[model samples]
Target: MTLTGHSLIAGEAVAGTEGRAFGINPSTNEQLEPAYGLVSTEQLRAATAAAADAFKPFSSLEPVRHARFLETIADNIEAIGDELIERASAETGLGAERLRGERARTTGQLRLFADVVRRGDFRGVRIDPALPDRTPLPRADIRLRQIPLGPVAVFGASNFPLAFSVAGGDTASAFAAGCPVIVKAHNAHPGTSELVGQAISRAVRDLELHPGVFSLVYGAGTSIGQELVADPAIKAVGFTGSRAGGTALMRTAAARPEPIPVYAEMSSINPVYVLPGAVRGDADALARQYVASVTGSSGQLCTSPGLLFVPAGEDGDRLADAVARALTGQAGQTMLTEGIASAWQQGFRSVESAAEVELLARGQAGTTANAPAPAIFSSNLDVFTGNRVLHEEIFGAASLIVRYKNVEDLAEATDLLEGQLTASVQATEEDYASAAALIPVLERKVGRIIINGWPTGVEVGHAMVHGGPYPATSAPSTTSVGTLAIHRFLRPVSYQNFPQELLPAPLQDANPWQVNRLVDGEAEIQPR
Candidate 1:
């Protein structure tokens, strides 16, 4: 359980000859001990080579074994206990309770994927029998099933270090798809990353699987990330970070000789629309909840509401006053790192200085070193349409209120919005007609639309989607959460007229895996 400041390359702790960096405590502005080593380009190459070597054996695992492997990884992560939580909290300025919840979420998703593997439904098996007695021509036998896309490269995020770090959803989904993974640890929480990486390595060692199934690498800067995506061994990528970082990786992936899919989750300002009826009734309660969502976790979540639309009338003025009153005197929370805190300050200031944007309320700053006071700004719908600055994401406890004339203005404003992860509507039964009219417009602009709720916490389940179009995510058809995420690392292949002895188990007539399939265009349902 001891911490070793070295990159783990395929179950081996490889010390880097490159430069080193230390994790800094943002709350105290102090450096943590045992600086983590950064790997050289050659070491990174070896890691990717190891992953490529493991692809065949790793991808060919049977149903029971593959399901158990994922479950064992979840057990190993939970076994780490308080050491993991304490280290994560110290590295990032998050609370112990929050880290515990994230740990449960990480393990829970792994177990969920284990169930998915056991069901054997992710293979997507289909078969078409030969019609030999046809009048003119005979149809040949054909079968199809999904296969793993070799090794995957996953980049961790700055926020939610546990749920989005090593062995998080990206890694879990890739493993569930029977693909090897190489994770580039987030520098903000190196110790946490190493601890979780060791847990995964231990699972591989105990299960007698290929050592190259997983690797955790560290590098000084963009060199390591660029080389990883360009490597032929890597087939796909899963990333979660800023828009700039995500787009940079996309460019690198596109420029390669053999292009790969990069599923990067970038910026999202998840907007909230307050209907006139709901704003007219119990505006104070709605204001309290709105303020809570805006300031939660210092507004560091990807789904935090950054923009809110309110009607411009006497009722709207009363709601706006309630919002300002609710946000006032609130204390700010500590941010993850010094760089993040600094960037947040710069972002809020840039938007605040824009024309037609005025500060409506300001909360007290925390006592911590990097914590800044939370604030809210107000503007008009016309200004929001013309001013591009108001549309940008400020990654902190800052939001903007845009007052619109009526439902028509609300719809028009929504049309100008960028693609987002989520959009919420605070409406009542009386406002159902207006809310229904905007559903189609919101559907085009966001991945998930919620009624009478805020967009702070994301649910992890079978139907959850943590993806969107363009800047929200690189791939619109996939999600980084839920069991559906496994499809990202899978590609379907059809076999024609293959010998019975040569066919794969799932596609064979005997149904060795006992999975349901579409036979002659009809689904053969199986018991779970």
Candidate 2:
């Protein structure tokens, strides 16, 4: 079967002018279809211009009307959620069940943004009353509101076709905030991206939005991404990919005359600390859970637990054996792309070269179409602390188990961990109490700290932060999940001496919206 999904520009599917990239199915190692060629400089300019122009009218729409548009998009996405997931699985080689769950999360995120708009939380409006005094001159009132950044460019990730692709969270948040989007589809799943892009197109028409509000382009090289971010019309960018790729685009954005904000959620190790008490009590269950987390989606998730810290003793040995057996029992599947598979192999070789690390069990290699079975390694904390490569993300179904001799050993390992999206602590109540001394140290190293849980399943809700310092993400203050993500699309604007008629609704004395906010120094739900 073959399918060619062309580039979408100005609400229309357009072919590339200069070059073409073939789409390779990771599941079969066979070419499925041809994707649109690299978007030339001219195409990038046109797309950027369309988005900039579209933003003017979209940003001017009333918040309520904007909220309705977002709801319509969510409705359209949900209506075709099944088809989206199926195609995503076929293209990217992810399992059907996992993709289905990701689809639900993706649509749920879109609706969450709708709810945020409906509640007027994103308005971020504030007002200070005018003051009249006899001894001093009268002062006019001050008002503040969120304004949309002009246009945003989004880069889809290879592992998550539906949730992080053309119509993913980055696009959904930008669209909900009244910022038009220009998406650069990942080559691994261009066909799936095209399908979802069409859904979004139908949505825009149904909601009576500008045709130029969205554009999806495809290219093999870095040129398209560079052109998009460097374009004067683009105001910001959202990216999820490797550090090398993200850093290149970030540098391009930073070099521009008017540097723009680039929110890039790069990869991470997402370490887990297994205390002695938990291992002593029930090492088997924790090992089984780790196996599932490590092999889930072939360890393609950015939050997969790559580096594990196990306490030393007879219990630690039992936990190691159980985890190794569990991973060996699970069958390995094809990765999202061949490039990823090759990289995984390269990482495996590197781990094999480490002197102190011992290979416990290695799954048999499969055909080129499938990845090798999961592998596990055992080592001491000394080796892990000495080698910086041990902390880097391997991006496959592989884990390194490090044994800690004492509290000091565990603390040393925790202190050396890089910034991560999640840090899991597997400990009994007593062990949890014992580790209280190291809790604050771990807190500063990760965005979210989990107890008796795996970090693979990221929930999309308020207070869900999928970002961390440095390698986990480029910006810690921003998050890729939840309604708070809309902040990326908004900037603050302050107004003074404005007439009552000219005042924004949120600043109006009527307090028509009745949204929760801070007034003076107190929390309230009324206009000044």
TM-score, candidate 1, is 0.99
Worst 10 residues of 2 by lDDT: 519-528
| Strongest candidate by TM-score | 1
Q: What value of lDDT does candidate 1 attain over all alpha carbons?
A: 0.91
User: lDDT of candidate 2?
Assistant: 0.81
- The CA lDDT of each predicted structure is 0.91, 0.81
Candidate 2 per-residue lDDT over residues 1-528, each given as its tens digit: 224457888787777876877667788878766555667788878888988889889887676777777777667767775667677777788878888788777778888887777677687877766776624677667778887898999999988887887877888889878799999988888778787777777777887888789888887537888989999999999999999998888899999999999999997888888887788867677878888899888889988999888888888889888887776667777888888988998888899898988987666555547576778888888888999888878898998998888876676677788888888888888886667877788778788888889999888888888888877888888888777788998999888888878876667767666655545445565442
Q: What is the TM-score of each candidate against the true structure?
A: 0.99, 0.95
The segments of candidate 2 whose C-alpha lies over 4 angstroms from its true place after superposition are 1-4, 134-140, 366-368, 511-516, 526-528
Residue range 166-275, candidate 1, lDDT tens digits: 99999999999999999999998999999999999998888889999999998743888888988999999999999999999999999998999999999999999999
lDDT of 2 at 225: 87
